[model samples]
Target: MNKDIYFEDVNIGDSIPTLVKEPVTKLQFVKYAGASGDFNPLHTDDDIGKMAGIGGVIAHGMLIMGFVGQAVTNWIPKKNLKKLNVRFAGMTKPGDTISVTGKVVDKNAENNIITCEVFAKDQNEQVKIQGSFEAKLPKKN
Candidate 1:
């Protein structure tokens, strides 16, 4: 669960707690597709994915991004988030266990803004997404 974090309590280079998610599954993809309205066969149909030369059905990039978001929020509250950006690095396939990790990269005491660099990688250490986020944290009195 995310707890309130103060700007003074964090420092540049400090590591955020890691979030390891269970292996990806087709069922989860289906649910995500329904919720996201993506309905892209490449993410839900093995045959179409294979035909597209991606081997087989792969998890949606946004789903993996959501995992990264979860990791960030696990460290700080969503209300504090100011900016988030990500680049899709690799495909996430079924049975791939993803682990999201991050570290504080910069901090501005005047603005109470903290910047963090984060990445989501599979069990093999294959990077699925890379990103950074900025959050305005409260300063302890």
Candidate 2:
């Protein structure tokens, strides 16, 4: 995919390929609950979710973050990863189409790190996470 984006192939203004994920649902919330060992009622019980002042069973923030992380790793590959950081900003409801996007913000060939600004947006164009990532790409010849 994308010829493995070598250090010599990208620039600060280059747009990273955007990845759109399927709409989030209760079933996915359940699966993520089991996989992460975080069966919080707020994520599974519609009643509990409402009582907590949130809409029915909001999606887990971690799960959404993971989706964004997947988009970056899938694009650049694991060998290039150096660091990733994100801040949760909004909640996602069922049936929302989550989109993950990123852009190459800076690149350092001497240290082999490519910095990118990453974000996950919902159907309403609301940001879920404001994040940044750094990956060490294959060195230029």
Candidate 3:
């Protein structure tokens, strides 16, 4: 694990470490479905996905969002995260590699809080998720 980031350690506009994940896979979809209890056929069954007119199976949006969350927690501890908001912008299919990145957009020393703008994009540069998060970091004594 990385050392804890204090409130004074980061500056507005600083870039967080980028997180690039392996290509989405059918087995991963199945595992995510089992863990999230979302057995929507579109995520696991190609036939159902075709029937839904999505061409083929698409990954769960929440799974992509989880990737975004992972990027944030990679930079700061999980306990520091106070708020996370995201919107699904595009579908992610099996075989698509997703990359999550963020920039620190705001910082509040009074509350030791920092806000970041975050995004997840496919290898083709298509946006899959857009979001923001707030983290209250510890202050140096």
Model 3: lDDT to the true structure: 0.94
Tens-place lDDT per residue, model 3, 15-121, is: 99999999999999999999999999899999999999999999999999989988888888998899999999999999999999989999998899999999999
* lDDT values, one for every candidate: 0.95, 0.89, 0.94
Candidate 1 yields a Cα-based lDDT of 0.95
Off by over 4 Å in 3: none
Task: Give candidate 2 regions above 4 Å deviation.
Answer: none
Over 79-140, each residue of candidate 1 has an lDDT whose tens digit, in order, gives: 99999999999999999999999999999978999999999999999999999999999988
C-alpha TM-scores of all predictions: 0.97, 0.95, 0.97
Which residue pairs clash in candidate 1? none
lDDT of 2 by residue, 1-65 (tens): 53567888878978778889999999999999999999888999999988988868989999999
RMSD, one per candidate, in order = 0.8, 1.2, 0.7
Clash count for candidate 2 is: 0
Ranking by lDDT: 1, 3, 2
- Score residue 81 of candidate 3 by CA lDDT: 93
Winner on TM-score (2 vs 3): 3
| TM-score for candidate 1, residues paired by index | 0.97
